[model samples]
Target: MDLDNIKDIWSQENPDTTPEISLENQKELHLPLEKLRKNMRKEFWSTIVLFVFIILFLTFVDFHFFKFKIYVITLVASMMLITAFYYYKFFLLYKNLTSVDFNLLENLKDLKFQFKLNEQYYLGYYIAFVPFTVAEVILIFEFIPGWKNLTGFSFILYLSIFCLLMLGALYVVGKWWFQKFYGKYFSQILNLIDDLK
Candidate 1:
């Protein structure tokens, strides 16, 4: 074939057409997206308040041992750092959702991916605290007067069991919390995508 003829055929075969969401579908998407954004805002602000309360409580509360206060404050500070990282990502998604033009199906798909990715991040945020929890527990045992009575293998065994149980509980609670806050809206978005498809 001549180059001119081949070019024409290629142009005809590959039109620059992207699937656009209909106005009706865009309207359908608005509710769930708004719900997700609202929930995110509420959670974010609540977390900030809770952290502030924790810091104040730690600073002002009377503890028998000074080391206990320091250790907890340090752990809370570390948690705040980790939380800041995750919230930065969360804020990006919040911004994306806010700015969604809903013009293309691909945009919705990308938003869905963001939701799923952030869901994983949410769980990781919880799991990340496991070490902090363990350390805090150890501090409690060391500094608290009552726990001093437990000695040797008994302390080790109890701490191990408690940590194991806490690990499982965190995972379960994380899943539940996600479902309660965002999963329902996520389901709605998935349904909207399916309808669009």
Candidate 2:
């Protein structure tokens, strides 16, 4: 193949016919994949750690150390599940982020698709917390074996106070964090779409 001659002809093409997903842009994107993949690997391992810790902790609670202790464990279990769920959501997002490569037309589409998936992931995260937050309150006061002292009224009062405090703090932190991280990325994707147009 006459590579030099092919480039000479290709470079002279009418600009209007070519889409904004240009070859140069795609080439630049390839450099980031390794970094993205590294992040994905880190996320994967962190999730495994969360899983193991939760299981081990629940096992400890099964030994029935104290009546009130189980409530504490139930709280811990709820927190762990919530933590693990959010991380898993991030893993899904990062997995898509890592797979993007702008080296081809299909890859550009893939990048956009990946970002859309990330958006859904965030919405899903919010939806999941709803049930988790509710169940955590319910489990603390209703379920969880070995209940003693603490009147049902007192139980509700203390549990509501503690969970509301934790949930509020977590919500604030999550809002700030989501805006700091995912919000920026999603905007970047929108800009990319504009560039593509």
Pick the lDDT winner.
1
Q: Score every model by TM-score.
A: 0.90, 0.57
After superposition, the stretches of candidate 1 with alpha carbons farther than 4 Å from their true spots are 1-14
lDDT of each: 0.87, 0.63
- What digit string (tens of lDDT, one per residue) describes model 2 on residues 58-129? 776555446556665766677667667766767676766666555445566666677677667666666566
Please give the TM-score that candidate 2 achieves against the real structure.
Answer: 0.57
Off by over 4 Å in 2: 1-20, 27-36, 61-101, 104-106, 141-159, 176-183
TM-score of 1: 0.90
Which candidate wins on TM-score?
1
For candidate 2, the 10 contiguous residues with the lowest summed lDDT are 140-149
